[model samples]
Target: MGPTEWTAREEVGVGPWSGEWPADDRYDPDLLAGGDRRNVMDAYRYWRREAIVADVDRRRHPFHVAIENFQHDHNIGTVVRTANAFAAAAVHIVGRRRWNRRGAMVTDRYQHLEHHPDVASLAKFATERGLSIVAVDNTPGAQPVETAVLPRECVLLFGQEGPGLSEEAQASASFVVSIAQFGTTRSINAGVAAGIVMHTWIRHHADLSSAW
Candidate 1:
């Protein structure tokens, strides 16, 4: 048998305004005239990038997300995407600055990002901001994330794909949390781990009524 074929789906987002245009300053005139095909929510359709970012900053969660980037890990983009989805305060990239953005699906434009030279720098930034550095890894002596008491305001740090947390990164963390796994896999994808950790924080600290 041949592989099943499916019809191509219609393009996402709305076309240009049909009648009178909104007079709001937040609306993007270019997007209004050229159509808004971006991946943003319906509420954000035709909104200017700056306006959307300003709106998000006003209500961003206290928690932040960080990842080690010494190896140019492709998962960084996915982490950014998940952070944006959770409305995290910011994403801190430790080590190398350049990273693949393809997986972010252009959400990086709406997300706040920071760059750090090393784990120590990231720790310092978190400390200055009164945010704890909570590392996510399955190393020994780590608490299970499912039952751990995550800080209400903290930087949830993750490491490279296979190597996990470096010695310096682990040492800088206030505590380490691990996701429980019944399967035999040694570890899950770094991006998937990030999503799980961020969602866990949301469940513990975020106001559910504000979710759209």
Candidate 2:
């Protein structure tokens, strides 16, 4: 089935009283009891919180996502949602411990998130796991992502909207990549840029034949 129709299958189990509360009930019971008004698709409606997270974890991709959060950027939520949709292994927040999740629409429950004090800490985590860290930026030294070879096991890192990337983040990455653009805008929205880089990684590394 195509993406549009993939979730059309009737959800087997959901609704009130179907299951126990998740060990980590990140959501309000009143919210869950009120028909799960969040933005998630129908298949996950009213399911116990942990069930959804477990399902997502089972199918998560090998690639991880890291974003510099020094500015408390509003786009972080959107980036988190997109990462969940793509089934990323985890999301590392560099330079900040908390970010607004309003744009995520509560999808953060299904995405594993890690906090790093700085870019160096994030780089250390990826390196320890043998994953190359690749930064997305438009600096003069950045390679065009469309033509570059992305690693099968790597972390795609991004930065804030106006500044693009921190000097430390760029230095920490094994290589920096840029998305092709012909428009007059100096940069795209950070969330959109993240989606582009993530989809590019999926195309080159994920097994589409097996993706649902």
Candidate 3:
């Protein structure tokens, strides 16, 4: 017999709820009646926006992610997506309020986001919250992140692509850590670097049993 042709994959998300509707306030009536096509975990399929955020807030990790958006960096969205995946306490966008959300894939809706006008503002926020600022850059005297001890309650700060961290950003940081690279590329983009540092924190502090 000849080999069969491959079938098309099913579309993502569920098409309305079957049987009795859930009475919980967390479930959205619109999503329950209509289909839910939001990019979210299976557990949050029919959840209301606020409910989902509340749920995530309850179990979010202690570490935060911050990115300098001086030039409307495209990597901001990817950084947000990765931050959401790792369940960072929140994502702080410093320097620019607006960023390209295409890479975030709507994950920004579920992730907590804060804005700061400058590096100084971010530093104040970290100080008030008792969080250390660990800047990621390949600047001189920057320790290798792989061997460094990342603080449990700290913000992993990343600079915009190409320019790297601003002088102010680096100065405000409690310390700087660089990701080791074996390739010919001089540096990794902010998005990938954010993911690596966030995962490093997860490995050191997160309770793995809670992971899906």
Models, CA RMSD each = 5.9, 6.3, 5.0
Residue-wise lDDT of candidate 1 within 59-164, one digit each (tens)? 9999999999999999999999999999999999999999999999999999999999999899889889899999999999999999998999999999999999
Alpha-carbon runs more than 4 Å astray in model 1: 1-9
lDDT score for residue 139 of model 2: 93
Q: What is the lDDT of residue 130 in candidate 1?
A: 92
List, residue by residue over 1-212, the lDDT tens digit for candidate 2.
10122233563323332355544454446545543544565666555677678777777889999999998998999999999889999988888788999998777887999999998889889879999999999999899999999998899999997998999999989999998999899999999999999999999988788675
Which digits, one per residue and each the tens of the lDDT, describe model 3 over residues 1-212?
11122233575677778778877899999988876778888888889999999998999999999999999999999999999999999999999899999999999998999999999999999999999999999988999999999999999999999999999999999999999999999999889999999999999999999997
Q: Considering TM-score, where higher is better, how would the candidates rank from best to worst?
A: 1, 3, 2
Candidate 1, lDDT over the whole model = 0.92
> Which candidate comes out best when scored by TM-score?
1
Which scores higher on lDDT, 2 or 3? 3
Which prediction has the highest lDDT against the true structure? 1
Local distance difference test scores for all models = 0.92, 0.83, 0.91
Backbone clashes in model 3, listed as residue pairs: none
Alpha-carbon shift of residue 15 in model 2 (angstroms): 6.8
